[model samples]
Target: MRLCGGHSGLLLLLLLLLTSEFPPGWSELFGWRDKKVLNVECETTGYEIVGDDFLVLCPGHCVGQQPLVWGSGVYASISSVCGAAIHSGVLSDSNGGMVRVSKKAGMRGYVSKFANGLRSISLPKWSRSFVFPEASRSMAESSQQWEQESIVSTGDKVDGRRLSFEAYRKGFLSSEAKPAAKDVSSPKGPNPFQQYIGRNLGTASRKPMTTTVSPKKMNKDCNVDIAFLIEGSWSLGVRRFESQKRFVTKVVEELQKTTDGAAVGLIQFGHETKTEISLNKFPTLQGVTLAMRKVSPIGGTSNAGRAIDEVAESFFQKSAGNRREAPNAAVLLLDGWPNDDLEVPARVARETGINIFIVMVEGATSEELASGVHGDFVNKSVCRPNGHFSLHTDRWTASSALVSPLVSRICNTERLICSKTCLNSADIVFVVDGSSSVGLENFPALLEFVANVTGHFEIARAGTHIGIVQYTYEQRTEVELGRHTTPEGVREAVRRVHYWSGGTSTGAAITYTRREMFAHSRSGKRRLLVLITDGRSYDDVREPAAAARKEGIILYAVGIAWAIKDELDAVANDPKSEHVFFVSDFNDLKTVGPKLVENICKEYNALPRN
Candidate 1:
């Protein structure tokens, strides 16, 4: 009853063909059809690694079903994880082996690229990825050879005949392998696939990926003063109006749960704008939600421009519970085009250090959204060119989906505040009067004030640069512009400034800063000088202040106890109220610090970008 040897071999081959677990091309070429298949071992380091069969290399809570892999120096979605490893030079296609993928910080900017036979689609910024361990020399050589041979011209078949392992081994043993010829006449650089290969092979330097601040981290770090501007006009029926209220309530709830320092207020705009909730009215989540539920729609014409103006003039005032230290943001939810012009009011709102985010509901056009933005729609003034601040939905029913993304945008303080003003692109010099009048007890307070103001800026050579000048008869440059390129470095340098008390020569300090500290100021960057004094200067400051202003330097005068008002007026720039600040005591400097920063941002925003 036993079958012949040939028949038995044929039966075994058929079984292997039907029960193969390896990918299509691999089983046929490598005779691995009957080999024992092993489940991928996903090792965990504190964070849980999800996906039982396919491992997700990225860190953080893996929210969705898709598995992310590190390919071509970026986080990409590939059809096959093992194939991507081979294409990324982490494994060899000839004989695939175990790969060790470690998680790292999320990065900004991902691009689509091709490698070997695999195609990778880019993931969004702040999306997590993994770090693949270096492959063995033999494996690397095989992967490199396979990559060079697999790349084909546009329109060519990618799944051509697979090369034998012996042939690949022989090619690896050779000194070098030539790649497929590309058309020399083409103007475009090598295809994305080639570039991807070059980056992995070390032929080209890898571009440093910018680390993105996670949403959770951003929520804790950013303090936002947000006002919700709702359009409750006749065009938006009661149902849609209710939907808008629900959306806003949900957003506030999310913010309350996640954000560290957040204040919420609402204004309903129709024929007239009504303040439903002041920024300081409800300090807790329960109160805000209760107030939101009680809001009744005001049926009339939509005067969006007036509502925006109200936000700029009244909603964000200190009386309204607007924190001077927090960045100002306004979320405008509109159902249709406004009857009044939006350009002038929006411009004024932006000029007042308010970042405007517009969400156009059904019946509103993208053109109106563009018009309502702070700058030209193409080049946004506040946020990045990526349209995170503006949103439009074709139907009101879909409004629920906008809450998470909107909350994320509001919490992203780096993009929300720093990108809007001169916080990221100016040179700020602090001139302190370290005289005998300012006793040793007050010196630390003065330094603390300087550090607090410095915290508002992103210290970088290409971004905002900070300088310090401590004057007591003679001026000393404690920190020079561009001396420190990081916030920590600048803060540390400020802490190290030694206090030396002598005579007060405010005029000489201003002149010294202008001559020594600002001599090397970069062109196309805003120049700002902040002068802090406790009393009147022994020497004249009017001429030096005037000279500083003449050279296009913006001056701010901060006077502590016993300081002369006349001197502050003479030292400050035009519109003295905006540029001059007075505090009764040295400890009150903390209260004035934010106001000074807000004013500086306003002045910086008013200047035309170079």
Candidate 2:
């Protein structure tokens, strides 16, 4: 029979009193029970309790189990019904209370901790668990008391001390029943209670009750134009399609909260591609979310490639609210394999300087994602290679967790910088000094620096072209312009450059790069020559450096160790601070690559478009 409210508790008490026999002193032991009997409505929603202590009837399944309790210094081993209630943190050991208990799906991990005077070990992920609507006020007060006394004196023999159940209960009760003054003295080592709590709670201290906090607003300085291309195919039913909309709404809500704000648009694709929200359609967060909610899924075959082309050709146009000055990005959410080709359209989109991020769910495979990205799908999408850009989830329910991470990636300013500059269309040649002074031990680091810088550009024959010239007493072209078009290809070629040892000939390397390497450079593309050396050149660099500049070569000089400042200044272009860089050791070259890329992009952006 279903039961609820104060009436249910009173009736249960009367029935128990009439039908049950009491042990010796049981009446006196439970004198406080006169206030409220156990409520039998374990399924009631929003059950309320007075003060702290009460009783709750457990669901039928929990009848034989030991009560699972967590919190510091709390103990409750009554009938399974009351014990499970206490274990769920609904009832405090101080007085007692009644609460409704509900079953929930098992968690990946459960944190066990002290509740009142009792503690429980962590349950495995597969173990069944129960939850209640709200914790009792007395439980909260008891938890506050525990947090205040979590740290004990260093002299306490808490380390590796195992007490029997009775002994441990007595010690815990005594410690909480009588409070000690706060010990402000510095701890000699880690506190034993803190360590114990950390072990059981899976954290350093008793986790404070989580309060609802507002989401973090996006950075105000980040400005970019983003297009979301979502597939609404028949495989994704209405519910999962709504999940995609909700995810996009959440991201747009956060993006619009910024001062500068990211301009976002949405395109829905199935059998055909349709622009659901134009970039200029919504001016406020509320408008964006409302518009997103109004969009209905058009279930058909997935045509992700067509949607990608739509975003590239139409969504980013000035008439559709594309900000020409801001970096462009397209996020494609695919639920299944595409009906058409992804590589050609994705490549075309990227060629227009739009960064493509692919989110694959359920039926979509990593191979499909790689085809859509058409570049470093794993690494280039985000700053680090954890596959942030190409996200995947096995189930629709878990897609909500991807929201914050996806928004952060889309708003990352550093990753967007290259899209705003002509770095993709520039011809870059690295001039290295493989002289005797630059020990062989340091040569790999120099190559690594070059690879790191090369990673920043979109390496392609029709895009940016990279060449390498290594010199000592003589010069040898390591990689000619347009020889390696892919980032991996360029990196591999850089790794294969054999170290040459002799006198420094920075000027001859510069002259050779201008005459040979720059000859392969395409017309209308910016010509950049990056010079790396550790010592002053044995031959004069001023004349050849000036000659290269006269021939329309932009020079950057990176000096390491004993390299002279005047030579670097002579080799580099004007504005020495931007064109010249120095580090004390070869290892520090890693830090200089990004700064150099930023400068390269800055110069490229400052120039008029061809």
Candidate 3:
């Protein structure tokens, strides 16, 4: 069964009535890594004990505490309640009213709700908001565009603003900040586009609507490597920026508790991508949380593609600390649609063997967010059975509540299943036209296109095997099926084959591919042939293509510049669009790389795993 849940207006209490401790995996799931008594450093004005639940009320500051609010999940404060209160009630000092507690079967604790009687309390002047050191360095140092727009925290700027801790506390405590102007709300409620417009035009501070809280379960599997890619763009705003940091901190807290633990990394990206914490940076959970709390948002455009590329190229590499044996993953917390297309880079990242989970807020449309998910894995696997991988929150603060559920999902990595040989179990052959038309200059482009297609598959004796056949006046088998045992080997061999530069004999190539490459593989793997050409064949291709199809070879015919559409159609597999492709020029071949890889992967996914 799929393991998933959502953040709602109720706290999830893990009851340990007898031991006065959490259930297995509870401490990790709830971000309860710090075992020391949280020094809220405030006077306990009142105390109540019901069963094993001990609720202590404090009058002032709580330094490091996770409070259980009636309608919210845990909040950072020792001033509220210090321990995990599985059973208890809160009494209003100003007014007396009934506090509703609803119990659900199989739930460890009850949902606590006050009847609109709990009022906001006034604070003393002596209480000042203490500023923590900035968590992460600026990410805009490398990008001129980002540097121009970045709101750098300099000279007494704790979090890009000179605000007392009292103000920061009040900002989060206030149920509703200055009623959003009538101009900001629509008949349907608050306008979603308000954040973008208000940010760019410098409108009045539109505080994110105070959100309700919620809760989750626990998972202990530690054989996973996760990297968090967060958007630190200006659009996230200062409050949201801090909220994102908190969410990340909680995830780190939870993941660090497993045996061996999940190796975690952090990447913050705006107009540029910055690696805030490398996967191997901090070996312990305490070190990870401490680093996370210091990360500040470096405002700029959200360029998720570049950030994805950075993770794919660097973060997961062995030299960069990624464990080759673990399942590699990236939890992308995106705020908006990237400035560039994510399809290619994301596909490349997936091809590199890292699973991607995209968490989009209000910034991008569903279609845009879905586009970045590797292999539509969000809909197919991550969100399988029920939950959604693309998490959408009403506002940024609410995103913090997602930490528990997100951790739960990630820890239950076993459930995030995929076919073992999803890209393996395939015998793929490429038929290329290396005539004078595709001169030495354009031939490499054709070869590069073939290389691009070859790069996405797993190349090994027992996995997907690759072969290449070049055709002109004479068809020559360049690489036999299952010959190259690695993608690097296949690519280097393809790159080394000098252009034949002869007459076009496409039919002969098809006949040669069937006779030389198709039947040699007795592996029962899916047979796929990609036929690429720039001109019509000197001989008929129909019979040769038919013979290959009769042998159950899935043919994909790609036509460039001078290649005839009719001949291309006759040569490709039935259901034309799925198998036939036409490109205007050899240079434009790179544009179709993602689509070709995706189609091939789709077919791979359809088959059973080896």
- The candidate that wins on TM-score is 1
In angstroms, the error of model 1 at 13 is: 99
The lDDT of model 1 is 0.62
Stretches off by above 4 angstroms in model 1 are 1-219, 364-386, 417-496, 499-610
lDDT of each: 0.62, 0.61, 0.55
TM-score of each: 0.39, 0.37, 0.36
> Lowest summed-lDDT stretch of 10 residues in model 1?
195-204
Superposition error at 569 for model 3 (Å): 1.1
Each prediction's RMSD to truth: 23.0, 24.6, 26.9
| Candidate 1 vs 2: which has more TM-score | 1
Query: What local lDDT does model 3 show for residue 265?
Result: 82
True-structure lDDT of candidate 2: 0.61
- Candidate 1 lDDT by residue in tens digits, 365-482: 5775555543343224233335877887888789878988888888776555433444666788999989999999999999999998887675654458899999999999999888
Ranking by lDDT: 1, 2, 3
Q: Could you say which candidate leads in lDDT? A: 1
Q: Write the number of the candidate with greater TM-score, choosing between 2 and 3.
A: 2
The positional error of residue 509 in candidate 2, measured at the CA in angstroms, is 1.0
